[model samples]
Target: MDVSNAFLHGHLEGQVFYQQPTSFIDSAHPDHLTFRSTLSDASLFVYRQGSTTAYLLLYVDDIILTASTADLLRQLTDRLRAEFALKDLGPLHYFLGIEVVRRADGFFLHQRNYAHELLDRAGMLNCKPAATPVDTEAKLSTTDGTLASDASSYRSIVGALQYLTLTRPELQYHSAGVPPYARLT
Candidate 1:
């Protein structure tokens, strides 16, 4: 999932400008533009080498890769590193705020770091961690507490939790509930 041309491959409704290329030095018009922009797909790119294959993922400057062979992976990584300024974050531990965990059971994606970030952003970072998420016997109702004056904030927390559920199905009950602060009130 590589963005072909990436920044140069997107549609622009308004004007875009850039300095002339070093190779295309314009002595006649030193300040003149050397390139005109165009629109194309930025979501995907394909590169093939013999029978082995590699996939490049590009989101702006961020990239992830999958390869059919280790040698191919190494070759692709080397080539990419040489061409672009990149950091080799080996083994894909984290991407797009989702944490990747490999276990005997299977691969798991969780927002543990993302969750922590959200909690910190919402000032819940230092809150005590409950032994369990919610009390099984605790009955939840819509009319439980006073309406939050900033409903948007409450909703934002819920939305973050909802995204967390992509890897944390077990937390669905806890994530989708009315705002925890409201519940306390």
Candidate 2:
């Protein structure tokens, strides 16, 4: 599920000065001042029941809630709705770029779509599949090759690959040693 305008719900701590949006100006509180609140801790809230537990993971505006039973899940959802405006997206299939597939054994998480998009962006969509993502024995040195013309793209792809490591541990072993600015040799 997703929260509508999640950032706006964040409570400012201390003194915050800002001109209210013209459209949202309140005539009653023209000189409105936001005060510190305990809302920031809402991102992660967990509930436990004996051997069972319910987990709520919040990333900015997106929220993923899971529980061992349907009744518990429903109770949590209702409580959340009461506190904030939430749009229930129903079952979890796609989140961030990870695709979740439920199986008899358990839930499987993959990032095929995200990987495809990354490959396309790198103009490697049609590239041949490699037996391994990187060469283990290849030695990369700073003085080995000329610098890439667009270092930003290289850094961007590396950053994306770092995120891809969430579902691809193999990539982590290969990429963990590569610095963001390391040029191809």
The local distance difference test score of each candidate is 0.64, 0.72
Residues 43-80 of candidate 2: C-alpha lDDT, one tens digit per residue? 56566766766878778789898888888788778877
Measured on C-alpha atoms, candidate 1 has an lDDT of: 0.64
Q: Candidate 2, after superposition: displacement of residue 106 in Å?
A: 2.7
| TM-score of every prediction relative to native | 0.48, 0.63
In model 2, the Cα lDDT at residue 84 comes to 83
* Each model's backbone clash number: 0, 0
| Model 1 alpha-carbon miss at residue 46, Å | 3.9
Model 2 sits at a Cα RMSD from the real structure of 10.1
Model 1 lDDT per residue over 52-165, tens place: 666665667677787899987787777666656566667877777777788899888666668777888678888865545567798888989789778899898878877666
